[model samples]
Target chain A: MAALNIEQIALDIASPLAEEPGALLPILHALQEHFAYIPTEVVPGVAQLLNLSRAEVHGVISFYDWFQAEPSGASTLYICRAESCQAMGSAAVEAAAKQHLGIDYHQTSDDGRITLQPIYCLGNCACSPAVMLDEKLYSRVSAESLVAMLDNLPERES
Target chain B: MSVRVYVPSDSTALSLGADDIARGLGEIDLDIEIIRNGSRGLCWLEPLLEIDSPEGRLGFANVTAKELSTLFSDGVPGSAHPRCLGLTEELPYLKQQRRLTSARIGLMKPCSLDDYRAQGGFTGLTKALEMSCEEIVACVTDSGLRGRGGAAFPTGIKWQTVLSAEGDKKYIVCNADEGDSGTYVDRLIMECDPYTLIEGIIIASLAVNADEGYIYCRAEYPLALERLQQAIELATDAGYLKHFKLQVRKAAGAYICGEETSLLESLEGKRGQVRFRPPLPAIEGLFGKPTVVNNVISLASIPGILAGGAASYQAYGSGRSRGTLTVQLAGNIKRGGLVEVPFGLSLRQLLEDFGGGTASGRPIKAVQAGGPLGAYIPPALFDTPLDYEAFKAIGAMVGHGGLVVFDDSADLGQMARFAMEFCAVESCGKCTPCRIGSVRGVEVIDRIHQGEQVEENRILLRDLCQTMIDGSLCALGGMAPFPVLSVMEHFPDEL
Candidate 1:
């Protein structure tokens, strides 16, 4: 959350990775890791670095659910919407979270605390109704547990 | 010697708060060696604390932070606590299994070369190194090990094609983009026993004469990715990797990329789209080189085949569907976890014996065999034995051995809608039937569900499904209709 040198960061991440075969994904992933979002400005630079058209870069970012064009909320809440989770009553889990957060899937909360997304599966099917708070996964999650998990979040410093 | 304790580091255990258990144990003033091992695939009892004793690894199920105080009350060796499952290997769930590919999972430090070697890991590589490429291929051929990721294609034949394919630069690609709702075997291998997969890949490279290899893993699997990175470095440093250079490529989150051709496209750093076959990935794939694109299980099975001899592996299962199938039981089931059984195990027995019936304590209505694209089989056909041909006979395919159970409360009508919706959301948009037809299928299912010209919509939906099944370029478009059609067929009253 400091003032970032976007160009410098992009070049530092993209330069070495772009040398590898099929380098575009790793570069994009690294850039996303450095800064939570892929900046619109960096796409052209990445395209130039990878020797791909801007359209191609944009297309890949748009296609995969992982890459984002703008900054996401501090915490991303991914609820599994696939069949196994559905069987375990994830519909109720999704409804409760959406209601509690006052936001829908693909929407960031107004306070910029949480952004919600629907993931197909987290590969924790046996413990169904899985939810991921960013990189950490939580399984056997109920609506009550999710709301509690979401409520305990400390607000981000501006 | 200090008492050894195992706390699983696999994604499932972590999700269920295995980290907390590890932390709790850290605070305890006991002379214990806390080892972060992988899960026993006994997920229902996850956060399962195992302690080494004169008997064996004694399991403590669903251990809370508060439970740790009492855990060591009787001393270093585990006690007969109320929750203690004595002799973990002798537990009915485990004793019943015929573990092969996943034999080492949940047993040792995943990235530790020493632990892996101690457990007879590198013998496969040593054996593979001794055999010629043709001999290895022949051994696999005789084993009759089909692709575990569903297609049931003979693994030996696929390798033979790539082996003979005219290309100096052949590539070995491991498809670890496991997005299926009910499957976790791939994730387990990548996160828990990563070196096994690495060994499998190295053996594959030797068999096909490929210098470079890539594991096309999903970015969703953060732990698996991290573990794999560590495992690769450890294997490389130990010189087990030899000249075969390996790298992990994070998949751009697309369900279609789980398909081999689309995966190759994604690895090329492009939008994942279905490519037409005939030039098959075996001949011209991944930068137009002869590539052997295999599922994690398909590759992981190779080491065992080489080390144990093909006939030993082939002896387990019936017919052409030889060797053990890593059946992942999930959804509304009691005892849901990984069961590595031979091919001909009865589906009903798998559910009732291994699964111990529905967790909801309700009548089981249907089970979705395979991933999202598989058919929803009714309980009437639960007696069906698990085989490629047997499942196919019932208008189903044992795609990836993922059996997601559902109780009586589940609405087949709504699930039929979701199958199309999932397709619409994840479709690569290459073919019209998949891209356009999925959207239409969702609409038609909605219309039918709403009772808006239900009969007309039903007919229309069937026609649409037929078109998608017949005309689509890839399995994503072609097979999305399978679930819907199966639902309509089995639960006739629902839709």
Candidate 2:
């Protein structure tokens, strides 16, 4: 993995805010948008700019599940494990995805193409089984469809 | 020539292939402007189509890709065929609703700033910027709007407490961790009309004299989290959230943190655990200063109360439960979605009229109003008004306005055990009644199921429930018994 260019990213983020006390969220958003995660090194820079402690900045970043410190895979696949989705056979779909992608929940693939995550509910209960690939939600997802979808994705190592 | 096309992003609509319809429409080579809006609350005929008209947005009950071509050629969006609830304005399910919090939901394009402004989005903040903190508190107080996050404490009282406190750096935290089963109203409101929630939070911060705010949403709602983040950006750029320094914080899938104190603890990057309440969140919350901790529904409802004044909101409902409740209808229902209705509507009316009964084509044996903590009411008690006091009279709560129905096939004993087990798993373990009592309750229910001294176990379970209710520190332990006890008492045959 390439070392995160924290100073460059922080500089990029700092230029937009102009030292606003309330720039923490925007800075965090900007960092996450650019790198898909907040690097640990940027904590002090964020703290200094926002007039907050390093721990305070870290606390706010870690509190939100969407904010990650580590670099994420190119794509994320969220499989629904809520009761409604479970009732329809998400377990089998999950198994198929895990087998096909070669990654467990919260783990990125070896090639770094995808990260598998288990979400409790997608609010697509009526459709029974659901899986969200990035921002797009696919309902009534079967094991076959799951495999097909994974196969269709662009290979990261290539 | 502009064409208005509406595609509902409501869960029920999505479940019924609205996404496919939207994708198909996007692919079509037609000069049509698509507006992906929230549900109209007419869940029965979902994927409901509508077009811009001189009268208003003309409604069609349900339309597929095939029907869309014909409807467009006709130049008239006709009535909902076969299942037309007629005009959305006339439907009792929608007509009777106060719609304060959900006023902009289906009326405006969700992500469009122009639509939000046209539908009175940030009017409250604009009005509130002129008022003093005390006057803002007084306005909320006069409105009689209580916290819709299950506690039913007056919103005005909570804000007044924060306003009166001394602090240079206060925080306003909006608890969007709606962990309750069969409840997606918060998610709906967040996804469909994100500005309302942002506006509410901004207004709330201004009222409480807080400079910063955080919206603690659960990880389960990724779509809601994404939309809220996007909305925050939009709000910031447009100077709504920027004026108050508010940001939406996402939770790491903790159900217990739906409680205010627990939510505060989680915001500080600690485990989502409940804290004791003598200090009270209003006095010392969110990094040990004054904080205004509110639920998504509670915060979102503030803008309307401020805009319409308290009297206009107060005049809608009965007793202390003034204003409206954004009731979420889910589970085994033919029609399931978010419906913002006035407090006076009866359970029977909501279930039969809005919900259209069980989706399984069977009789609804039981209905669990509120979240899992709420009691399992029998069909005989369907006529009971859904007001907070009325629900309390029947040993129930309108908790977060989640109403889940179950068909005749449901097993009451199993359902009772599930509730106890749920409480056991989700308990913060701060107090004993919830920690140990839930385990014992589960054991006793299991004993009954096994017919091992069934009658004695039933008595034992009842006694345990009473002890837990009286001895528990918070609602987690206290309300856990409601579902178990209510099912045993009301649905003896099912058990």
Q: Evaluate all candidate structures by whole-model CA lDDT and list the values in order.
A: 0.91, 0.78
Q: Which pairs of residues collide in candidate 1?
A: none
Give the lowest summed-lDDT range of ten residues in model 2 chain B: B76-85
Top candidate when judged by lDDT against the true structure: 1
DockQ of 2: 0.16
* lDDT (10s digit) by residue, model 2, range A1-158: 23456766686676677454345655676777776878888888767766678988887676545567788788888886644444345678999999998879889888888888876566554444678886677766889989999989876542
DockQ for each model: 0.87, 0.16
Error of 2 at B30 (Å): 4.0
Per-residue accuracy of model 2 over B223-297 as CA lDDT, tens digit each: 778788887887678776555777777676556788888888777655556888889989999889999988888
Q: Write the per-residue lDDT of candidate 1 for residues B453-473, one digit (tens) a residue.
A: 989989999999999999999
What's each prediction's TM-score? 0.98, 0.81
Model 2, stretches more than 4 Å misplaced?
A1-158, B10-16, B27-29, B65-87, B90-92, B493-495
